[model samples]
Target: MQSLGPLRPRSTVLVKRPWLTKPFNWRALSSIPPSDYSNQSRGGLPRFFSETLPSSKGGVIRVQGDEFWHMTKVLRLKTDDRVELFNGKGGLVEGFIQNIDRSSIDFVALEDPKLVLPQTPQWHIFAAFGSLKGGRADWLVEKCTELGASSVTPLLTQRSSTISDNRVERLQRVILAAAKQCQRLHEMKLNHPMKIDNLIPLVAKSKQSFIAIAEGTPLVSALTSTTKESSGLIIVGPEGDFTEKEVDLITEAGATAVGLGPHRLRVETATIAILATLTLWSGSQQISNC
Candidate 1:
């Protein structure tokens, strides 16, 4: 049997060559390596797939685009290579690299994954915050994923400086990578950017909503006083804060005004705090299910 030593972190390209190749009885393989898989630092989606080997098996999920590039180029993975696959389904699936070429690679799923979906009451953390300056919006999206935000909506407010350039493809990668690392099976819903005027109409459609004001009502008190039977929404303003008219419009639309803390936080900070609190609350309710 031939061996391929532990992967070099700095290796640039993995090419196919007889001398560089190793042999293994893929059919005899029993499990995935512990060193190659991790479920920490994952966020955004409850479930996602990285371009690497399958962690385990079941019905396969969709993973297209750049992920296909990683499989074909970076990994230098070839057909029949034994690999690992995970789906955040509470189990791992052992698979074989059945198809591999310059264009794509498909793993034949073999076993069940280990991570299962949460069965608790769903918490819909919807945010309507002003877009940030330069690349700050990207940073917000990445961190928000880790904080367990289910969806994020960029809001255009009077105080916001400029609208962000649409880079949907790049942003989606950040979310996908986070989800794979955390073993989350679901994806974060990212809504298109819209003005506060358009957002007001949707607020009335929700049964529960909260707007995080820097100084209005305390976060805990506001949340505890509300009914927990339905999913909720939270709106955060830009660094300069929401305009008086905007706040009143949202309030009249049924959004409860709430505060995050005493000190004022940046747009991203406030958004993450809201998501973290909601995620914790949702996770606690599902303790018995986990």
Candidate 2:
């Protein structure tokens, strides 16, 4: 391995944040990606997402297409601008604009890019927000990504409204933007829309699983015994909530039903609440996954 010099602090950390508006070329979102929809820029350096990075130290990594536009136009970066780059899979490197143009930017890796694998025991959230009114579903994904969830899968139950592929692609952009903002190493993954029946095997594969239900065990109390770092799954129902048979099916597949509170919560609200509570519980148990 080649020895590397210490990272240089950016002389000026641009205050301008990347424009993350959705539907900005939906095709670009489908083409590109982000962290749990989040990441925190280190050393005050601006961060951007790339699909791939160079294999060896001092390699050349190219930024083009929407990514190129974001850097050149949105961020208005110039040659020699010190910046950080990350691939969604935990690869990160500090490099400078070795060259630039209207079409693309080329970065010269200062040090070999390093890949940090995501920790074990990822917590995957399955939510039925297909029918959420307005942008609540989008908001739920944004916040969840910022919180560093392992993955979010749109759940389909008896009450779930049908979701289109285009919508999923739209959510992908939200995920990308959030991951970049939080400076998360591993991009929080966004799974495809899944039917309740399809989730049965996944539930069993998890070391632990929880389903949110109105008269069930308290959320915190439900996670009390199993916080030592192991993979798990959590499910949230759609508008009318899961039917008794549906809940029973998941429960029989080794999922425990946990209660949020007496008041009924919106689909998005319930999903975020459960995710946030789990994040806190994991922190207390020395297993903060976020």
Candidate 3:
């Protein structure tokens, strides 16, 4: 009742105090504009591989070795930055950098990771190509992953060139790099080199399979008309292509021989062409059904 400036009107006091009528806009208090972090909020950010990335959130993931050098030296990412992570086994997570060091990086998972389903139904490519001369094998692995091949088996056919053990290791590195670059959650499986005869049984088990041959039914026709199976395999032969006896063996194993084009393709070229053809055909079929 002590006259406070003649009771300066309760309504005026409420109007002057914004908190009385409106809630605080916390987002507007951010120092960095919303657009500054737009890329980090989306799924198309640069990805890194951590074989041990946890499916659930709250664990710290360590990035070491060449990946560390890449993030620190090349990309120059710093603390508190965000990155996309994959485990090369269908696990994908968005992580926030917690710490960095000379040899490694530690990031904390912010939320539950996502599992990316393969684009194609478990399609395997039993590529029996010869040991490519230069960097062709590396290129083949990279392109094959982008084209949606689930796995690639190197076949040591009768006509294949000599492949050193180091070559396979190098090719595995290429597969990993390619998978990360293409944002493929599942890394394409790279099998040890095996003889052509040893691969027939694997082909026989596929629900639908094809062998890329120079003179056979058109690939598109075969793929388009085939029953949609859960699993399939495509066999690609060496540089000189599979011999008559080898062809007979594969045919007997139930793989339909399909032709890619009129002209013969090199081992790498043919591998990509066959895989690309199948990927497109399968995608079209899915869209039509949708």
Candidate 4:
């Protein structure tokens, strides 16, 4: 038998590198676009979402799936294209595309992200989903994301229809797209559906809780009377509205009944009304403080 010397590992050769040749440049990454979106952010640069992101610079961030498709195929982004990335948790960063493949985009973040502090008294909505038909729920989710609500949860009630996990997932997709469109540093949340019984306990423990009903305190007035620093929970039912027993459970848990107006509103309309009112109210409150 022939004696062989200790085997050495084979060296691998590279033809083309997928990553950017030049080092990451914060300035280039952040270079401003034309004055089209003068009010805020880079106009030329598009935004994408990665569920979580690196806190500081030089970390490789990979974006995949739907976000990746939008970046490459849909948006036709090329290597070295500047773009903004945000995590749903109040994190926003500017970076340039360093590499791209069939399924993912790799980029490096080299600067501290601009952090957006949550609005004072962040508001959340717990709405009944069973009766929302013909894409009403999707519209609600999209609009809520744009309007800057903290989170939205579907509620189970006697008169409401049952929502599937698949439907909730669909709403989540809407949230992402809308967040990107509105340039939110923090994406609006879409929570798993909860039963009115389960919600009653949460409502009981909440400092500010309100319910929409036929006769009660005016919506705006109710919000105005609350302290500025209190986070709120707003509950709205489906088209059929909450059953007598469901209302009893919710209200007994310390939810203040609030009326929208003379006219009755659908689940989607009423929920939007509450959120829109809250948005305008929050802005005015900030101005007053300033």
- Best candidate, TM-score: 2
lDDT of 1 by residue, 1-290 (tens): 01112111121223233222333233433533322233322322122254332323433333345655666576656677665554332244556666665555555556644334433333344344444556666777776655555566667778774344446555666766665554444455566666778777778887777788876788778767766632567688877788889889999999888887789898877877776676565444321111
Regions more than 4 Å wrong, model 2: 1-41, 225-229, 284-290
| Whole-model lDDT per candidate | 0.56, 0.71, 0.68, 0.70
Model 3, range 1-290, lDDT digits (tens) per residue? 01111111011000113112434232332132223332332454567877655434665656787677777898898998888877665566778878887677877778666654434445677776546778888888888776657677777778886457677777777877777765566667776666777777777776778888889899878867787664577788887888999999999998999997788788888878877666666653221110
TM per prediction: 0.66, 0.81, 0.79, 0.79
Question: What TM-score does prediction 4 earn?
Answer: 0.79
- Report the candidate with higher lDDT, 3 versus 4: 4
Per-residue alpha-carbon lDDT of model 4 for 58-167, expressed as tens digits? 65667777878898999899999988887665566778888998778887775656555554436788888656777888999888777667788887787776777677
Runs in model 4 deviating more than 4 A are 1-44, 221-230, 282-290
- Looking at model 3, residue 154 earns an lDDT score of 76
Model 3 residue 228 CA deviation (Å) reads 3.3
lDDT of 2: 0.71
Reference-based lDDT, residue 103, model 1: 54
Best-fitting candidate, scored by lDDT: 2
* lDDT for each residue of candidate 2 in 46-90, tens digit (9 for 90 to 100): 888876655444667667776677788988889999888887776
Q: For candidate 3, give the lDDT of residue 158.
A: 81
